[model samples]
Target: MIGRIRGILVEKTPGQALVECSGLGYEVDIPYTTFFHLPDTGQEVTLHTHFAVREDAQSLFGFASRLDRDLFRLLIKVNGVGPKLAAGILSGLDADQFIRCVEARDVNALVKLPGVGKKTAERLLIDMADRIKQLEGQFVPSAGGGSLPEGAVKPVTGSVSDARDEAESALIALGYKPQEAAKAITRVAEEGMSSEDLIRLALRSMIPTK
Candidate 1:
Protein backbone atom coordinates (compact mmCIF):
# COMPACT_ATOMS: atom_id res chain seq x y z
CA MET A 1 0.00 0.00 0.00
CA ILE A 2 3.00 2.27 -0.21
CA GLY A 3 1.90 4.52 -3.07
CA ARG A 4 4.80 6.96 -3.06
CA ILE A 5 8.22 7.57 -1.62
CA ARG A 6 10.28 10.71 -1.19
CA GLY A 7 13.86 10.31 -0.11
CA ILE A 8 17.49 10.56 -1.07
CA LEU A 9 18.34 8.43 -4.08
CA VAL A 10 21.25 6.21 -3.14
CA GLU A 11 21.88 3.90 -6.07
CA LYS A 12 20.55 2.98 -9.53
CA THR A 13 20.94 0.33 -12.17
CA PRO A 14 19.12 -0.80 -15.30
CA GLY A 15 16.16 -2.25 -13.44
CA GLN A 16 16.82 -1.19 -9.87
CA ALA A 17 17.20 1.80 -7.61
CA LEU A 18 17.77 2.30 -3.91
CA VAL A 19 16.41 5.22 -1.99
CA GLU A 20 17.27 6.24 1.54
CA CYS A 21 14.19 7.13 3.54
CA SER A 22 13.96 7.74 7.26
CA GLY A 23 17.43 6.28 7.82
CA LEU A 24 16.48 3.13 5.93
CA GLY A 25 17.29 2.17 2.34
CA TYR A 26 14.69 0.72 -0.01
CA GLU A 27 15.24 -0.89 -3.36
CA VAL A 28 12.79 -0.52 -6.19
CA ASP A 29 12.73 -2.00 -9.66
CA ILE A 30 12.31 0.44 -12.49
CA PRO A 31 12.00 0.43 -16.23
CA TYR A 32 14.62 1.91 -18.53
CA THR A 33 12.53 4.99 -19.17
CA THR A 34 12.63 5.81 -15.49
CA PHE A 35 16.35 5.11 -15.39
CA PHE A 36 16.89 7.44 -18.33
CA HIS A 37 15.27 10.29 -16.45
CA LEU A 38 16.88 9.76 -13.06
CA PRO A 39 18.78 12.60 -11.41
CA ASP A 40 22.29 12.31 -10.05
CA THR A 41 22.84 10.31 -6.88
CA GLY A 42 22.34 11.89 -3.44
CA GLN A 43 19.56 14.12 -4.72
CA GLU A 44 16.17 14.27 -3.05
CA VAL A 45 13.66 12.48 -5.20
CA THR A 46 10.11 11.25 -5.24
CA LEU A 47 8.56 8.31 -7.06
CA HIS A 48 5.15 6.75 -7.51
CA THR A 49 5.47 3.14 -6.49
CA HIS A 50 3.58 -0.13 -6.69
CA PHE A 51 4.11 -2.68 -4.01
CA ALA A 52 3.80 -6.31 -5.06
CA VAL A 53 3.43 -8.91 -2.37
CA ARG A 54 3.35 -12.67 -2.54
CA GLU A 55 3.85 -15.53 -0.15
CA ASP A 56 7.60 -15.51 -0.55
CA ALA A 57 8.46 -12.15 -2.01
CA GLN A 58 7.79 -8.45 -1.68
CA SER A 59 8.99 -5.91 -4.18
CA LEU A 60 8.53 -2.31 -5.13
CA PHE A 61 8.35 -0.96 -8.64
CA GLY A 62 8.76 2.74 -9.31
CA PHE A 63 7.76 4.95 -12.17
CA ALA A 64 8.67 8.45 -13.11
CA SER A 65 5.08 9.06 -14.11
CA ARG A 66 1.75 7.66 -13.08
CA LEU A 67 1.11 6.73 -16.69
CA ASP A 68 4.17 4.51 -16.65
CA ARG A 69 3.08 2.74 -13.50
CA ASP A 70 -0.45 2.29 -14.86
CA LEU A 71 0.94 0.80 -18.02
CA PHE A 72 3.07 -1.56 -15.97
CA ARG A 73 -0.04 -2.81 -14.20
CA LEU A 74 -1.81 -3.33 -17.50
CA LEU A 75 1.13 -5.20 -19.02
CA ILE A 76 1.24 -7.73 -16.23
CA LYS A 77 -2.28 -8.74 -17.15
CA VAL A 78 -1.04 -10.00 -20.51
CA ASN A 79 -0.83 -13.76 -20.78
CA GLY A 80 2.96 -14.18 -20.81
CA VAL A 81 4.29 -10.89 -19.48
CA GLY A 82 5.71 -10.77 -15.97
CA PRO A 83 7.00 -7.86 -13.93
CA LYS A 84 10.45 -8.10 -15.50
CA LEU A 85 9.12 -8.17 -19.03
CA ALA A 86 6.68 -5.39 -18.32
CA ALA A 87 9.51 -3.29 -16.98
CA GLY A 88 11.51 -4.12 -20.08
CA ILE A 89 8.66 -3.10 -22.35
CA LEU A 90 8.04 0.18 -20.60
CA SER A 91 11.72 0.94 -20.50
CA GLY A 92 12.00 0.38 -24.21
CA LEU A 93 8.87 2.18 -25.38
CA ASP A 94 7.44 5.39 -24.09
CA ALA A 95 3.76 5.46 -23.13
CA ASP A 96 2.56 7.75 -25.91
CA GLN A 97 4.16 5.73 -28.68
CA PHE A 98 2.99 2.47 -27.17
CA ILE A 99 -0.60 3.69 -27.03
CA ARG A 100 -0.41 4.74 -30.65
CA CYS A 101 0.90 1.36 -31.69
CA VAL A 102 -1.89 -0.43 -29.90
CA GLU A 103 -4.53 1.91 -31.28
CA ALA A 104 -3.27 1.38 -34.80
CA ARG A 105 -3.04 -2.38 -34.40
CA ASP A 106 0.60 -2.13 -35.29
CA VAL A 107 1.81 -5.59 -34.43
CA ASN A 108 5.07 -4.68 -36.14
CA ALA A 109 5.66 -1.97 -33.61
CA LEU A 110 4.76 -4.21 -30.72
CA VAL A 111 6.90 -7.11 -31.84
CA LYS A 112 9.86 -4.82 -32.08
CA LEU A 113 10.03 -4.55 -28.34
CA PRO A 114 12.18 -7.11 -26.61
CA GLY A 115 10.24 -10.14 -25.37
CA VAL A 116 7.13 -9.43 -27.44
CA GLY A 117 6.29 -11.79 -30.26
CA LYS A 118 3.73 -11.68 -33.03
CA LYS A 119 1.10 -13.57 -31.08
CA THR A 120 1.75 -11.48 -28.01
CA ALA A 121 1.51 -8.21 -29.90
CA GLU A 122 -1.72 -9.30 -31.51
CA ARG A 123 -3.07 -10.33 -28.16
CA LEU A 124 -2.15 -6.99 -26.64
CA LEU A 125 -3.93 -5.03 -29.33
CA ILE A 126 -6.99 -7.25 -29.36
CA ASP A 127 -7.20 -7.57 -25.61
CA MET A 128 -5.88 -4.25 -24.35
CA ALA A 129 -6.69 -1.38 -26.69
CA ASP A 130 -9.79 -0.31 -24.80
CA ARG A 131 -7.94 -0.43 -21.54
CA ILE A 132 -5.29 1.84 -22.96
CA LYS A 133 -7.88 4.49 -23.73
CA GLN A 134 -9.15 4.33 -20.19
CA LEU A 135 -5.65 4.66 -18.78
CA GLU A 136 -4.86 7.53 -21.13
CA GLY A 137 -7.56 9.56 -19.46
CA GLN A 138 -5.56 9.45 -16.27
CA PHE A 139 -2.13 10.02 -17.72
CA VAL A 140 0.22 12.76 -16.57
CA PRO A 141 3.96 12.68 -17.22
CA SER A 142 6.29 13.52 -14.35
CA ALA A 143 7.97 16.92 -14.54
CA GLY A 144 11.60 16.85 -13.52
CA GLY A 145 14.73 14.79 -14.03
CA GLY A 146 14.34 11.36 -12.49
CA SER A 147 15.14 10.85 -8.81
CA LEU A 148 18.54 9.17 -8.79
CA PRO A 149 21.35 9.46 -6.29
CA GLU A 150 24.73 10.83 -7.30
CA GLY A 151 27.31 8.76 -9.21
CA ALA A 152 24.78 6.48 -10.86
CA VAL A 153 26.28 5.00 -13.95
CA LYS A 154 24.53 5.85 -17.19
CA PRO A 155 23.07 2.67 -18.62
CA VAL A 156 23.72 3.39 -22.27
CA THR A 157 24.15 -0.19 -23.42
CA GLY A 158 21.09 -1.22 -21.49
CA SER A 159 19.12 1.50 -23.14
CA VAL A 160 20.25 0.35 -26.57
CA SER A 161 19.25 -3.20 -25.85
CA ASP A 162 15.86 -2.08 -24.62
CA ALA A 163 15.32 -0.06 -27.78
CA ARG A 164 16.31 -2.93 -30.02
CA ASP A 165 13.99 -5.30 -28.27
CA GLU A 166 11.05 -2.92 -28.58
CA ALA A 167 11.76 -2.21 -32.22
CA GLU A 168 11.81 -5.90 -33.06
CA SER A 169 8.53 -6.52 -31.28
CA ALA A 170 6.91 -3.60 -33.05
CA LEU A 171 8.00 -4.83 -36.45
CA ILE A 172 6.46 -8.22 -35.80
CA ALA A 173 3.28 -6.72 -34.41
CA LEU A 174 2.99 -4.59 -37.50
CA GLY A 175 2.79 -7.74 -39.62
CA TYR A 176 6.37 -8.46 -40.56
CA LYS A 177 7.45 -12.01 -39.95
CA PRO A 178 9.40 -12.67 -36.77
CA GLN A 179 12.55 -13.31 -38.72
CA GLU A 180 12.13 -10.01 -40.51
CA ALA A 181 11.52 -8.19 -37.33
CA ALA A 182 14.64 -9.62 -35.77
CA LYS A 183 16.73 -8.77 -38.76
CA ALA A 184 15.50 -5.21 -38.92
CA ILE A 185 16.03 -4.64 -35.26
CA THR A 186 19.54 -5.99 -35.49
CA ARG A 187 20.39 -3.68 -38.33
CA VAL A 188 18.98 -0.73 -36.49
CA ALA A 189 20.87 -1.62 -33.37
CA GLU A 190 24.11 -1.80 -35.31
CA GLU A 191 23.75 1.86 -36.13
CA GLY A 192 24.24 2.84 -32.48
CA MET A 193 20.69 4.05 -32.07
CA SER A 194 18.56 4.32 -28.96
CA SER A 195 15.37 2.27 -28.59
CA GLU A 196 13.04 5.08 -29.62
CA ASP A 197 15.42 6.02 -32.35
CA LEU A 198 15.75 2.40 -33.48
CA ILE A 199 12.00 2.10 -33.72
CA ARG A 200 11.98 4.97 -36.17
CA LEU A 201 14.90 3.63 -38.14
CA ALA A 202 13.51 0.12 -38.32
CA LEU A 203 10.26 1.48 -39.71
CA ARG A 204 12.20 3.00 -42.58
CA SER A 205 13.82 -0.37 -43.28
CA MET A 206 10.49 -1.96 -44.03
CA ILE A 207 10.03 -2.93 -47.66
CA PRO A 208 8.27 -0.14 -49.47
CA THR A 209 5.26 -1.27 -51.45
CA LYS A 210 4.51 0.09 -54.88
Candidate 2:
Protein backbone atom coordinates (compact mmCIF):
# COMPACT_ATOMS: atom_id res chain seq x y z
CA MET A 1 0.00 0.00 0.00
CA ILE A 2 1.34 3.44 -0.87
CA GLY A 3 0.82 5.53 2.24
CA ARG A 4 2.72 8.64 1.16
CA ILE A 5 4.59 10.13 -1.78
CA ARG A 6 7.47 12.62 -1.74
CA GLY A 7 8.77 13.58 -5.11
CA ILE A 8 9.08 16.26 -7.74
CA LEU A 9 5.68 17.42 -8.86
CA VAL A 10 5.80 17.04 -12.64
CA GLU A 11 2.30 18.15 -13.57
CA LYS A 12 -0.92 19.23 -11.90
CA THR A 13 -4.46 19.63 -13.11
CA PRO A 14 -7.67 20.33 -11.22
CA GLY A 15 -8.19 16.80 -9.96
CA GLN A 16 -4.86 15.06 -10.48
CA ALA A 17 -1.08 15.30 -10.29
CA LEU A 18 1.94 13.50 -11.62
CA VAL A 19 4.80 13.13 -9.19
CA GLU A 20 8.14 11.77 -10.27
CA CYS A 21 10.15 9.75 -7.81
CA SER A 22 13.26 7.84 -8.73
CA GLY A 23 12.57 8.11 -12.47
CA LEU A 24 8.93 6.87 -12.19
CA GLY A 25 6.10 9.34 -12.64
CA TYR A 26 3.02 8.37 -10.68
CA GLU A 27 -0.30 9.90 -11.51
CA VAL A 28 -2.40 10.42 -8.40
CA ASP A 29 -5.96 11.64 -8.27
CA ILE A 30 -6.53 14.47 -5.79
CA PRO A 31 -9.32 16.60 -4.42
CA TYR A 32 -9.61 20.34 -5.09
CA THR A 33 -8.41 21.00 -1.56
CA THR A 34 -5.12 19.31 -2.35
CA PHE A 35 -4.91 20.82 -5.79
CA PHE A 36 -5.09 24.32 -4.32
CA HIS A 37 -2.27 23.67 -1.87
CA LEU A 38 0.19 22.12 -4.30
CA PRO A 39 3.47 23.77 -5.20
CA ASP A 40 4.29 24.54 -8.81
CA THR A 41 5.44 21.83 -11.15
CA GLY A 42 9.08 20.82 -10.52
CA GLN A 43 8.91 21.60 -6.84
CA GLU A 44 9.16 18.81 -4.27
CA VAL A 45 5.88 17.88 -2.60
CA THR A 46 4.67 15.38 -0.09
CA LEU A 47 1.22 13.83 -0.27
CA HIS A 48 -0.65 11.29 1.79
CA THR A 49 -1.99 8.63 -0.52
CA HIS A 50 -4.69 5.99 -0.53
CA PHE A 51 -4.28 3.03 -2.82
CA ALA A 52 -7.41 1.33 -4.11
CA VAL A 53 -7.26 -1.93 -5.97
CA ARG A 54 -9.98 -3.50 -8.05
CA GLU A 55 -10.00 -6.65 -10.18
CA ASP A 56 -9.21 -4.68 -13.31
CA ALA A 57 -7.47 -1.54 -12.12
CA GLN A 58 -5.40 0.10 -9.41
CA SER A 59 -5.83 3.75 -8.47
CA LEU A 60 -4.12 6.15 -6.12
CA PHE A 61 -5.75 9.08 -4.37
CA GLY A 62 -3.64 11.81 -2.83
CA PHE A 63 -4.26 14.55 -0.27
CA ALA A 64 -2.38 17.70 0.63
CA SER A 65 -2.92 17.19 4.34
CA ARG A 66 -3.68 14.34 6.72
CA LEU A 67 -7.13 15.69 7.53
CA ASP A 68 -8.11 15.72 3.87
CA ARG A 69 -6.98 12.13 3.46
CA ASP A 70 -8.82 11.04 6.60
CA LEU A 71 -11.98 12.78 5.45
CA PHE A 72 -11.71 11.12 2.05
CA ARG A 73 -11.53 7.68 3.68
CA LEU A 74 -14.42 8.46 5.98
CA LEU A 75 -16.55 9.86 3.18
CA ILE A 76 -16.34 6.65 1.17
CA LYS A 77 -17.73 4.72 4.11
CA VAL A 78 -21.04 6.59 3.96
CA ASN A 79 -23.80 4.83 2.06
CA GLY A 80 -24.34 6.23 -1.45
CA VAL A 81 -21.14 8.25 -1.34
CA GLY A 82 -18.55 7.12 -3.88
CA PRO A 83 -14.98 8.30 -4.34
CA LYS A 84 -16.04 10.88 -6.91
CA LEU A 85 -18.75 12.32 -4.67
CA ALA A 86 -16.38 12.27 -1.73
CA ALA A 87 -13.92 14.28 -3.76
CA GLY A 88 -16.71 16.61 -4.79
CA ILE A 89 -17.74 17.26 -1.21
CA LEU A 90 -14.20 18.06 -0.22
CA SER A 91 -13.95 20.31 -3.23
CA GLY A 92 -17.13 22.14 -2.35
CA LEU A 93 -16.51 22.76 1.33
CA ASP A 94 -13.51 22.77 3.58
CA ALA A 95 -13.27 20.24 6.43
CA ASP A 96 -14.32 22.60 9.22
CA GLN A 97 -17.35 23.92 7.34
CA PHE A 98 -18.37 20.40 6.42
CA ILE A 99 -18.16 19.29 10.04
CA ARG A 100 -20.30 22.21 11.12
CA CYS A 101 -22.89 21.40 8.49
CA VAL A 102 -23.05 17.78 9.63
CA GLU A 103 -23.25 18.75 13.28
CA ALA A 104 -26.00 21.25 12.61
CA ARG A 105 -27.84 18.87 10.29
CA ASP A 106 -27.92 21.50 7.56
CA VAL A 107 -29.37 19.52 4.71
CA ASN A 108 -30.00 22.66 2.70
CA ALA A 109 -26.35 23.65 2.64
CA LEU A 110 -25.27 20.15 1.81
CA VAL A 111 -27.72 19.94 -1.06
CA LYS A 112 -26.42 23.19 -2.55
CA LEU A 113 -23.40 21.44 -3.95
CA PRO A 114 -23.68 19.47 -7.17
CA GLY A 115 -24.89 15.83 -6.96
CA VAL A 116 -25.82 15.92 -3.23
CA GLY A 117 -29.51 15.63 -2.43
CA LYS A 118 -31.71 15.93 0.65
CA LYS A 119 -31.70 12.21 1.35
CA THR A 120 -27.95 11.99 1.09
CA ALA A 121 -27.54 15.05 3.31
CA GLU A 122 -29.76 13.50 5.98
CA ARG A 123 -27.83 10.27 5.77
CA LEU A 124 -24.56 12.17 5.98
CA LEU A 125 -25.76 13.95 9.12
CA ILE A 126 -26.87 10.73 10.77
CA ASP A 127 -23.86 8.72 9.71
CA MET A 128 -21.13 11.30 10.19
CA ALA A 129 -21.80 13.45 13.26
CA ASP A 130 -19.86 11.30 15.69
CA ARG A 131 -16.97 10.74 13.34
CA ILE A 132 -16.83 14.43 12.60
CA LYS A 133 -16.35 15.23 16.26
CA GLN A 134 -13.63 12.62 16.54
CA LEU A 135 -11.75 14.09 13.62
CA GLU A 136 -12.25 17.66 14.81
CA GLY A 137 -10.82 16.84 18.18
CA GLN A 138 -7.69 15.53 16.56
CA PHE A 139 -7.06 18.52 14.31
CA VAL A 140 -5.83 21.95 15.37
CA PRO A 141 -7.03 24.90 13.37
CA SER A 142 -4.35 27.34 12.34
CA ALA A 143 -4.15 30.68 14.11
CA GLY A 144 -5.81 33.72 12.50
CA GLY A 145 -8.53 31.64 10.87
CA GLY A 146 -12.01 33.01 11.32
CA SER A 147 -13.62 29.60 11.75
CA LEU A 148 -11.78 27.34 9.36
CA PRO A 149 -9.59 24.65 10.83
CA GLU A 150 -5.89 24.71 10.01
CA GLY A 151 -6.11 21.25 8.59
CA ALA A 152 -8.69 22.49 6.12
CA VAL A 153 -7.21 25.88 5.25
CA LYS A 154 -5.63 25.23 1.89
CA PRO A 155 -3.50 27.93 0.27
CA VAL A 156 -5.45 29.98 -2.26
CA THR A 157 -3.26 33.06 -2.65
CA GLY A 158 -0.89 31.99 -5.40
CA SER A 159 -2.73 29.15 -7.10
CA VAL A 160 -6.36 29.04 -8.14
CA SER A 161 -6.56 25.44 -9.31
CA ASP A 162 -9.12 24.39 -6.71
CA ALA A 163 -11.11 27.59 -6.94
CA ARG A 164 -11.06 27.33 -10.71
CA ASP A 165 -12.36 23.77 -10.59
CA GLU A 166 -15.25 24.64 -8.30
CA ALA A 167 -16.14 27.74 -10.27
CA GLU A 168 -16.03 25.83 -13.55
CA SER A 169 -18.27 23.08 -12.23
CA ALA A 170 -20.67 25.55 -10.69
CA LEU A 171 -20.87 27.42 -13.98
CA ILE A 172 -21.42 24.24 -16.00
CA ALA A 173 -24.22 23.21 -13.68
CA LEU A 174 -25.75 26.61 -14.22
CA GLY A 175 -25.74 25.91 -18.04
CA TYR A 176 -22.47 25.81 -19.89
CA LYS A 177 -20.26 23.21 -21.53
CA PRO A 178 -17.24 21.78 -19.71
CA GLN A 179 -14.61 23.46 -21.90
CA GLU A 180 -16.36 26.80 -21.97
CA ALA A 181 -16.72 26.99 -18.20
CA ALA A 182 -13.11 26.00 -17.60
CA LYS A 183 -11.75 28.60 -19.95
CA ALA A 184 -13.89 31.39 -18.51
CA ILE A 185 -13.01 30.59 -14.91
CA THR A 186 -9.33 30.40 -15.76
CA ARG A 187 -9.60 33.87 -17.21
CA VAL A 188 -11.31 35.13 -14.06
CA ALA A 189 -8.57 33.73 -11.84
CA GLU A 190 -5.81 35.12 -14.00
CA GLU A 191 -7.34 38.55 -13.62
CA GLY A 192 -7.19 38.23 -9.77
CA MET A 193 -10.01 36.44 -7.84
CA SER A 194 -11.54 33.95 -5.45
CA SER A 195 -14.09 31.22 -6.14
CA GLU A 196 -17.00 33.48 -5.24
CA ASP A 197 -15.51 36.22 -7.38
CA LEU A 198 -14.87 33.80 -10.21
CA ILE A 199 -18.48 32.71 -10.09
CA ARG A 200 -19.62 36.28 -10.74
CA LEU A 201 -16.94 36.88 -13.37
CA ALA A 202 -17.76 33.66 -15.18
CA LEU A 203 -21.40 34.69 -15.26
CA ARG A 204 -20.44 37.86 -17.06
CA SER A 205 -18.23 35.90 -19.42
CA MET A 206 -21.16 33.62 -20.22
CA ILE A 207 -23.46 36.53 -21.08
CA PRO A 208 -24.13 37.24 -24.77
CA THR A 209 -24.43 40.98 -25.31
CA LYS A 210 -25.08 42.88 -28.51
TM-score of each: 0.67, 0.75
- What 10-residue stretch in candidate 2 is worst by lDDT? 201-210
**Which runs in model 2 stand beyond 4 Å of their true positions?**
147-190, 194-210
Q: Can you write out model 1's per-residue Cα lDDT over 93-163, one digit (the tens) per residue? A: 65665776777777876776667888988888887887887674553333353233222333333344566
Report the C-alpha lDDT of model 2 over 81-169, residue by residue, as the tens digit. Answer: 98778877776665666776777677877776667888998889899987775576545745666444433334533435576777777
* lDDT of model number 2: 0.73
Model 1: residue 25 alpha-carbon error in angstroms:
0.6
How far residue 154's Cα lies from its native spot in candidate 2, in Å, is 5.8
Report backbone clashes per prediction: 32, 2
